[model samples]
Target: MDKIKIRGLEIWAKHGVFPEENVLGQKFVISADLYTNTRSAGKSDDLTQSIHYGEVCQFMKTFMEEHTYQLIETVAEKLAEELLLVFEHLQGIRLEIAKPWAPVGLPLDTVSVEISRFWHRAYLALGSNLGDKEAYLRQGIQGLQDRKDCRVTAVSSFLRTAPYGGVAQDDFLNACLELDTLLTPEELLDVMHEIEQEAGRERLIHWGPRTLDLDIIFYDDIVYDTPELHIPHIDMQNRDFVLNPLAELCPAYRHPLLKKTVEELKNALTEPEEAHAK
Candidate 1:
């Protein structure tokens, strides 16, 4: 919500497509806008409460000088990742890498590449219905945690639920997890698929029994849908298994499409069953 700007910091780094450019370094002007909450730091007058811009500058300089890349785009991309990783206080960053020395024979001052990268909050629904279902679910969480680009922030207590989709299978262990990740939606899906494969999950049957099932329930209140994936997880409001776990971890987390909080959805789904039993 607050901004700390670092502009026009110059550095010399070896990064270019040409062989000679790699051998001979060039001047690169780096700029970054670090985003975070600085209110506590400002009020307390404590350096520990906020990000240190001076340290960030030194880190940028050292990182650029150490790594060699073929394109300024690569430099910006990799540098953004590095900065976000190094500074735990930084939630997002806008980075620019400018190459002033152009090999072009024409008159040109410089060329640059800029990128905006941030840690995205994502909610994941995890389920398993095969042998050692709890083990599969735990393994899936560990796999996500192992990735450098992903951080598991919170986890809901696991719930036992009857299988959905009319599949004749064992009871499922279901839960929701909160994560902070730098990966894009598709990239995160790929990671989930990898975990599923590791758990020996098969996709032969649609909505059928599986060793593990991981679905992206939410990504920063974003409404996204593609042929391969859908955000708000298509009819999640109707599934008690999904909502119950979500309510445990984040009852206030609202569904962007449904416009209902997790607690509301969970209550709406359960109230009718409760009345029926009464």
Candidate 2:
């Protein structure tokens, strides 16, 4: 990653809890470190290959002046998201918003809010065994795509597979997708749950059946385990339904803990005595 630094860019904006402060704008100093791949720009000396700091500064100024928010936290968050969304070359950002004229009764040099935000790559497994299976899968994909913070980068062909867990349920439609998202793991889970609920999912049985099932299989090669969620989904390697679709989207994607590629995992799984697929 390369850096594009912009420091002490000053702007006048109305944002505060106090009425007087809102009426009379105050000076805000903003600084940002934009992350990206500048190799092309450096090699070709082409401005188009790099993020333009001048354009970014102008965008920040315009954005700050146009919006009115009570908290600098909100300003920083909104600004960071907008910059990432607007600038294709920018991969991440560390932004700081300093309020020189704080309304605090005590004398202080400045009050500021700083945050680092970046896009993350995540893989998900999608499954549906109930009514309108394919429709539910499409709805789940669309739900994720509809969010500004998430992008569906690739989708695998949906496959029909026999039910796991010996629940005697109908065959399931399963698939996988690659996601580029700004949401954290927990946040992404919440979104998945929301999408599942929208499709009328119920969790009465353990892997029994559902309208939609969205599982986070991987997040940026990081291993995460908690009571509520687990990355590199615990049992994905043994399930052909998951591995088959995943191999389609990312055959070389390695599991952090298992250290095996999707293709390898799929090939290694021992076929059940009863066929797992229709």
Candidate 3:
């Protein structure tokens, strides 16, 4: 990634804990590092291929002047989100907000807050076995798309498959969804839980019948294992239901730990074990 740096851009804004500070306002210094691939812009010398720092500065100044917040932390968080949303070409950003004038009587140089934010790609598997399974899956996808922090990039055709956990239940309609999201793995899980709950999902049995089921299959080629969640979904390689749909959308997406593409995994699952021994 190439960098376009904006350094020490000053602004007058009303952001402070004290009422008087808000009334009188103060000066803030903002610095940002915009990350993007500048290869096309560099070769073609096309302004359209690159983000204009001047426009960004004006946007920041107007945004600061228009909004009043008590804490710089809030300003940084909200502003970073706004910038990412507005600038489609930016891959990520490091933003800093500095307040030079302190209310404290004691001498101080400045206080500042800095944060880094970026979009992450993640894969999810959706399943439902209860009433109107297709409707539940569609609802789940819409719920994810509605979030400002999440973007649904692709969805595979739903598959009708029998239950895997030996539970005597109706066959499930399953599918895979790809997303570009700003939420961490845990945050994404929480969003999924909210969607499932909205569809009346219950947790009486492991792999039991449900109104909706959402699982995090992969997150940016990351191999993550935690107490609550597992990336590449534990045992997904052996599940034809998961691998088949995944292969449809991302046949070449490699599993970080297994180092095998989705197409390869799906083929391995269908191949006879005797062939593997030979």
Candidate 4:
């Protein structure tokens, strides 16, 4: 990724925790580093191929003036989101909001809050075994698409598979999806849980039957495990239900820790499973 930097743009606004500060107003300096690929603009010498810093400055000025928040953290956060949303070309951004001339009446000249925000790629495994299974899977994808921070890019055709974990249940409709989102992994998990609830899913038993089940199998090659969730999805490599549909959409996407392609992993499971049924 390349960079387009906007430095030390100042905004005088009514923003602070204290009543006196909000009423009196103060000066805040803001800076941003917009991340993107600028190859097209460089080669073509085209304005349309690049982000316009001048336009961004005007946007920041207008937005800051229009909204009054008591906290600089709030301003920085909302402003960062606004910039990312308005500029589709931006993949990541580092934002800093500085408060100068504080009423401390002593030493410090200014204080600032800095933070970075970026887009993330995630892969999801989908399954449904209760009610209209296909409908449940489709509804899950639709719900993801409806979210502001989440975008569904690709969806694999649903496949039929026997329930895993050796639990007795109806055949499951399984599939995979690719998404780009701005939400954190924890936040994304919350959304997935909400979708499961909406689909009338019940968690009475482990690997139990359900109206829907959605799992976060990958998040940009990240790997970690927590009591509530696991990345690279714990047993994803060993499960055909997960790898089959996943291979359809992203054959080349490899497990970061396992170093296996979706196709390779699927084949590894399929060959033995087929031989066993003989």
Among these predictions, the greatest lDDT belongs to 2
For model 1, where is the 10-residue window of minimal lDDT?
99-108
Model 3, 103-220: lDDT tens per residue? 8788999999999999899999999999999999999999999999999999999999999989899999999999999899999999999999999999999989999999999999
TM-score between candidate 2 and the true structure:
0.94
How far out, in Å, is residue 158 in model 1?
1.1
- Local distance difference test, per candidate? 0.92, 0.94, 0.93, 0.90
lDDT for 226 (candidate 1): 94
**Residue 142 in candidate 3, Cα distance off native in Å:** 0.5
Q: What's the TM-score of every candidate structure?
A: 0.98, 0.94, 0.95, 0.95
Candidate 2 regions with alpha-carbon error over 4 angstroms: 270-278
Q: Whole-model lDDT, candidate 4?
A: 0.90
Off by over 4 Å in 3: 273-278
Better of 1 and 2 by lDDT: 2
Cα lDDT, model 3, residue 120? 92
Candidate 4 local lDDT, residue 86? 84
- Best first by lDDT, ranked: 2, 3, 1, 4
lDDT of 2 by residue, 1-278 (tens): 78999999999999988888788999999999999999999999999999999999999999999999999999999999999999999899999999998988899999999999999999999999999999999999999999999999999999999999989899999999999999999999999999999999988999799999999999999999999999879999889999999999889988989988999888888545336763
Every candidate's CA RMSD: 0.8, 2.7, 1.9, 1.6
- 189, model 1: CA deviation in Å? 0.4
lDDT of 3: 0.93
